[model samples]
Structure formats: C-alpha cells, structure tokens
Target: MNRKTLVLSAVIGLLAPVLAGCGDSDGGSDGGDAIVVGTTDQYAATKDAPAPLDPAAAYDIGTWNILRQTVQTLMQIPRGGGAPVPEAASKCGFTDRENQSYRCTLREGLQFANGDPITAEDVKYSIQRTQDIKAASGVYALMGNVDALETNGDSEIIFHLKSSDATFPYKLSTPVAGIVSSKLYPKNKVRDGFEIDGSGPYTFKADVKDDTIVQATFTRNPNYKGDRNIQNDKVELRSFKDSDSMGKALDSADIDVMTRAMSPQQVQKMLRSPKDGIQLTELPGLEIRFLGFDTDAPAAKEKAVRQAVAYTIDRGDLISKVYDGMAEPLYSIIPSNVATHTNSFFNKYGDRDLAKAESTLSDASINTPVKLTLHYTSDHYGAGTQKEFETLRDQLNSSGLFDVSIKGEEWKNFRPNQIDGDYEVYGMGWFPDFPDPENYIVPFLDADNTLNSPYTNNTLRGQLIPQSRREADRSAATKTFGKIQDIVADDVPVLPLWQGKTYVASHDDIAGVEWAVNSSAELSLWELRRGSSAPAA
Candidate 1:
C-alpha cells in the first residue's frame, strides 16, 4: 500500500466545554477501574453531541487535550518524551522524489470506536473540510500553504504541496489534522454549539450537566493495528473552576491524577515536601512569556528606547523572586532547549546593565521623559506577574528617563485590546502550534503576522523562512531560522522575558508517566495507569 499525505485548507470552530464521567475499578473484587484525571479549567461543553470528531474546528488547548483521548492522529511525539511515532498510520514516509509530496498508508482494520472503518477518504475529508470552512475557522491560518489532497486508493493518501516543507508532516501530527467522519459532518458550516463524533481509545459514555462527565471502557478496536504507545483501558476526566479546589480534590483522592494549574508558591511547597504523596515532574516548555511593545507608541518606535527598557528589566531576578524558581531566564522568543534558539539577545543586552540602558537612552537624545502604560493579564500566566511588572516599572522609573503606569485586565478583554493596539506595552505568552522553527518564526515574524503587532519584516517573510523550509537537508533549516532570530534580537518589537518550565503534580497511584514540551504538555491519557491497590501511604 502506497500511503500519500496531502494538505487541505479549512476553518475549525471550537465550542466551550459542555457539561461533563465513568467507572471500572482497575483491580480487586470491587469494580472501580477507571483512572480519574482532574484539571482546573472551568469547561462549559454542550449536552447533546455532534458528528465529525474533527480536531480542526476545536481551538482551545483544553478541548484538544480531551479530544486526544478519543481521536488518533497520524503521528504523536510520545507524551512520555521521545521521537515522533506512527499512531493511526502503520508505516508513513515521504516520497523519495521531489521531496515535497508525502504518503502514509493506513494500518489495516483501524476502526472508529463507533465501528466505522477509518479510510484514506476520512483523512481527505478532514483536510478538505477545513479548507471548505476557512473563512470562519480560526484553524485555516495553519493550513495557508496546503495546495491539494489527492487520494491514490482506499488505503493510501498523497499530499502535494505548493512547496517542500519539512515541517508539514509535524503539522499533520497535530490535533488540527485529526480525521473526522465524512458521513456525519454537515456540508455547510457547523454552528458554535454542535457536538462531535470521535474515534480514539475511549468513547464518551454519558453527558451530565455542569456537575461532571462520565466515560466508559473502550473495547480495543480490533482494527486498531496502529501504534503501541497507549496502554490504558479507560479514563475519567473531571473539571474544576480553579487550581486550589483541584488541589483539594487531589488531597481528598476525589481524583487519582491532578495536573491542574498550580501556583508557583504551591509548586515550591510541593517540591519541598517529598512526603506529600505528590510527585512533581518538570519539563522544558515551548512557552515564552514576553513583554510586547506597541510599536506605534512614539517612545517604543525608537530602537534605543526599546533596548533601554529591555536592559533595565532583570530576568534572573524575576525568575528567582516572582516565579519562585518555576521559570527559566529567557532571552530568545524560542525556548533554549529547542533548535535555532541562541543567546543573541543576551550577547547584545548583557547582564542587567542599567548604565548601558541609560547610555543607550542618552545616545538616542530621548531627553523628553516618555510616560508609557504597561498592561498585563491578571488571571493568566502565574500569580507573580503583577509584581514582575511592578519591578519593571520601578527599574524604568528609577532610570529617570521613563514615566510608567501599570494596569491589568482579565484575559477576555486583554487579548482584544492588545490586538487593537490599546496600550503602550503589555505582557504575553506563546505556546507553539507545533514544535518546529517555522512555528516560532511564521506566527510572529511573517509580514502578515497574525498577532497584528505590526512586526512586518520582509527579510524574515520573503527570504529567511522560505530559504529555510526549501532545504532538502533538515540541518540546513536552522540557518534560516537563526537569521530570523537575529533579526528579532535587533528589531526588539517584543522582548523575550522568560521560558516557562512545566510542572505537574500527580498521585503516586498514577503511573506510565509521559509528557512533551509543546502546548499539549500533559500525561497522555492512554498511557496512564491506576495502581492495583491504594498507594503506599
């Protein structure tokens, strides 16, 4: 069977979490075998379900996390951390010719939990559906370069692209390309509150109200002749409104696993106490917490002024004090452990050189004291963000060159205002779309940058990225992205502040631990196992 992969354009719509389920004891004469997972997000899912368990339409990371339990992608970077492996597809590789086209032959007998056979047509339908609804779908942006999706036969699908992109396969592995049932999805646009059909290891059993969700044991699909990474028989996910309550849930054993939002202070406390029946797992996260400047602001438009502000703020101090050692000092937009990341910004800025900042401002002759307003999100990121910003204000104000005022808003209004150029400066963070240089470069550097921060650099868009992706050799990809990073260091439209270090606390009963650096940095539900008996207490 010759497997072919193709790109399709489409928009994915995400609905809030509807009302959320399940039971089967893992061992003993009693019967409560399901592994219970808890999260701190206040999810609002719908009661009735829809067809087309499509990953494209779903946008929120939380929703995608749950969908992964029920749907399989072509490849997944194992949650336990390792190279990407085949999941739904049995054997997948690129064409030796042209280097642009790719193919993935499906494993024979792969069927949805609902018993529908998964075929190449399903993959084609999933890709084409996103293209069909591109205008309204936020996900269409990810598939901008997809040209055609051609299926060779029943088992094989071939993807032909406008250009050769090494990262294309990685994109296919994301939730955005999750296959949907062609027969179930409507030909027209899906409304906001629509339900979805899914084909993964587990099936949705009952849809309760705001109380909780219940799932049931997923009989192994005989057709599931795919990857062997998943090892769990069933899973139960319960949602909470915040981290404190979720922590209490874990304490009471209301849930067996808790990887919910934990405050830095709480994480520090957990790390200190080895006897808390909680284990903390830390991984390099593909997240960059940043301070963004509104380039339109008169003071911000000047390079020296921006450089001055960058210098006055101390990253190491912030990490030690504000983040409680939970974050790593960051100088590049791309996290340090990833490919193409360099300390170019650090080389230019030096170690909190306040004098250099003053000297830079002195050279710019920006004698006119410039007052700037800095905005931040109160709920998002961690709790110490406000103190971090206050420290920034103090440093800049003490320079006697800047007059600073700080304000904060909830995430809802904060995002729109930043997009609209509402404030002089603000804080933001990024979780990669996929773990590649293109993900770091394309979204923020492209001339048509989606964040709309006016970071239009033709050299980055027209030359740097294209030059990188066209290379047949993977090693050569770094040069182009490296140049883009250098440009970012010089331009300084957005100052990289710190790299997020992901921390998870789970009960000793939970085993088969796994995680990765990208946005979906959680234990893969399929691999989680509850101990046969109560943990040693």
Candidate 2:
C-alpha cells in the first residue's frame, strides 16, 4: 500500500496458485477475458494534491497498485514470499559490510513502455523525485536512509545510506523504487496529468473523469523485461463508489475480482453464507488501523490528554462494534503477527479504564471533557470507515472524558489536511512496503515519520532503530523493538487500535486468484487468468 492507504498494506505469504482445472499459466486463452477488478479505492490529483500516477509523489495502496503494474522496481518480493530478488536489476546487493552502500546492475536491454531506455540514471531520478516532492502521502519518508545516489555509467546505480541498514534492500523492493523514464519526469516538479513510463510487467492506461481515476486498464507490455510471469495479456481494474456496487458488479459478471473494501460486515457475511460461483479468498496481511495525533494541536499537544484518550479507548468494544470480529484488538503499533509484538498499551493502561483516563488528566491539571476533532476519509477504506469513526467517537464520548466529534473527507483532501495538522487527531492506516519489524515501527517513529506527529525519541530513532537495522535476522531485534513499543505506549503519540485482515473476492473461474496479492499486499495483476468456464451460478 502507498501512503495514508499507503491506504492499507502489502501482500505476502500466498496460497498455492488455484488449481481448478487451470490451463497454461501464462497468457491464458490469449487474454480474451480482460478480467475486471472492482474496489471503492479512490485517489484525486487536485492542484494542491500530489500527482495521481507519478511514482515521485504517489504513496498510497491505490496508486501503488497502478505503479506495481506499470513500473518495475530493481528488487521484488517473490510471489510465494521470500527474500526479494532482482526485477529491473540483473543483480542487486549491499556492496559493503556496514550495509551502508548498495548497488544494482540494470538488466540488459531494459526499455520503458514508451520506448525510453531504463538506465541507472533513471533509477536515480525516480528515487530522487520521491524524496524531493515529499507529497502529502509522504513517499519520501520511506527513503530517509539514503544519503546520496551515484551512477556508474548507464548500467549501474549505487545508494549510500546514512546508517548500516540491512533492511535497505527491502526498501529498494517497494513501489517507491519503481524506475521511471528520467527523460520524461522532471527533476524537481511533480509530473502533472495521467502519464507514466516504466519497464514493469504491464503497460497501464487510465480513464480519468473530473481528476479522478475512473478506470485503469493494464495491458501486457510486449516491451517489458522483468521477473513477473505475464499470465494475462490484459487486465482491467474498475473503481466503484462503495462495496455494495462492487459486490453487485461481481454478481452481475461485470467485475471478475474485487478487493480493497474495508467492510468487515460484508466479509463476515460472505464467509458465513458462501456466494455460489464467487470464491472469497483471504490473504495473510498486516494492515493496521490506528489514531494518529497531531502533536502540535491544541488538546492533543499535551501528553496527558493523549494518554487519557489512549486509556479511554476500549479496543475490544471498538473492534466488536465496528469490525464485527473480523479484526482483533491490537495493543501495540506492531501487531501480534509480527515478531516482538507486546501489549505495551494494554500493559500500561489496561484497556478502557475510565478512572485511569480521569486521573491522567487530573494529574496534569487539565479540565474534564477534552474536546477533540477526529478525522478520516469517507471512501478510501470502504463504506464502514465512517461507521468505525462514529462508533469510536460515541464510545469515547460515553466515557465522559472526551467530547469527540468527527470530520470525514476524501483521501486527496484529507491527506493534505492531516499532514498540515488540520485535525487534532486523525485516523490513519499502514500497509507495509516490506515484510519486516522495521516496516512496522520505523515509519511512524523515525524523524520525518509519516504520521505527521512531532513526537520523537533519540533512544528509539537514533539508537534502537539504527541498531535494529544492522541485524540480518529480524527476530534478533526483538528487545530493540520491544523498547520502541514501550516508548510508544509511554508517549501515546498514536493510539493503537486494530489490525485488519485482507480478502479478495473473485469468480471461481479465475485460476490465479490465490496468488494475486503478494505478502506486502501488492496486487500482481499479471497472475489472474480465466479458466475453462465458470461454475453454474
């Protein structure tokens, strides 16, 4: 996922490729089906908002889905989940023991879909642009480790890091590392309109209406040279306004696949009463929904106020009311599935102790009923997000400790305002760029952390994070991440909420549905193919 939907997270750990009497794995039936995917996912490129398709500025799951199809990164996670391997690069690895300098050799004869060569210079430019624009989605935050970029002629690119980060390779594998044609994209300014040139698995074309991407079509790139298996010659991704329409489309055979709907109720319903000819497959995911605080905002600026809100939160009641048991209560920023998950908040606050909240404010000499404005996007995370926020507001208000009100807007406008600290406290979600403990903690804790919180701790960022980065074995960094989570609980900059499960609904005839979403939650559109025929409805 890209920023703020950075809209949800990535796909990893896949089910075996669907073996339902499938035929040839690549270019099945000569791409006659043109499988359509439906989602409520939306992004807009306003004058003030970041450019929609530009990899330099775009940083949300919706945008990344398009970029993943059209732009190839140097390194990519294997379809079944393992260490990343080279994509655009013939070979890539850290060149030094310190893990500070990394290098990649461009694959021979690589060319952008539009005919420009994908050179080392293009890799430098694409990564450089993301850092420069620092769009509201904040793709720049992910590249903070790179101190400088160097090119060796046209075939090689070198990255010098500020610290010895073993995870640097994983970062390089994300969509943010997608190599664009340097000749077309500007060095400093964000590219405008709907145009992109890359050497990924597919060439993309989008239909835009009123600055919104109405439909995105992915055609197999004949010029493309990469690691992906092009199973489908063409794929059409259609956007919808809500999950209901998406479901209807799937029912009416309008859409062959549907995902990105944050409706837990719908998930439960589908799982309970299975839909005939429609298979709902669940992917292993690490999507988290948390409340991000604008540390400079009025009441939320106070540590005690933030802590009180944290203490007032009842994750069980909140998840039950909003997610309907589809999501489990999360007590740490890092969910339980990740290594080093600790119930730091639960250990400190004990889940919805009203007296503790009252005492926290009282101890800080603050008055009762701390008024807070909670914010969220209306459409991005499915139709249920509004209800989730409303349920949270009512739950907190019922505690008589917070006079919480909500503000809902579209992703384009909400991201900018949230970045500018427009709301006292805002809702945010994370879909990791890679599979690692660093992916869970660093983005929200580091200087230039993407959450827009001014909160920082030298012990965590300057010491523990960099220390953890040097360890090749992620499990060895447990104690370091444990301390980081403890500091998060103590500071309460973000109120840990619930972790989400990802699901994809598709027609049974789609052979590769199980292999579609990779571990990082990225869509591998090239994997989808139509089998012989759909089962009778």
Query: Top model by lDDT, which number?
Result: 2
TM-score of each: 0.81, 0.92
* Residues 1-537, model 2: lDDT tens digits: 100011222222212222222222222112245888887888577877647788777777888888889888999877765577898899999888888999999999999887777788888988888888777666787887889999999999999998898888888888888887657788888788877677887887889899888888888888888878778777888889889888878778788778787378777787778765667666545788899987888778899998998888888887787787567888999877766788999999998889988999999999988888899988787777898899889988999888989989988788878777788888988887777768878778787767666877789877998888887766677888889899999998888898876777777667776667643456888887787443221
Q: Highest TM-score among the candidates is held by which one?
A: 2
- Where does candidate 2 have its weakest 10-residue lDDT segment? 1-10
Candidate 1 clash figure, as a count: 40
Tell how far residue 292 is off in model 2, in angstroms.
0.8
Model 1 TM-score is 0.81
By how many angstroms RMSD does model 1 differ from the true structure? 8.7
Question: Any idea how many clashes model 2 has?
Answer: 22
- Computed on alpha carbons, the lDDT of every model, listed in order, comes to 0.63, 0.78
Residue 160, model 1: Cα distance from true site in angstroms: 1.4
Q: What are the clash counts of all predictions, listed in order?
A: 40, 22
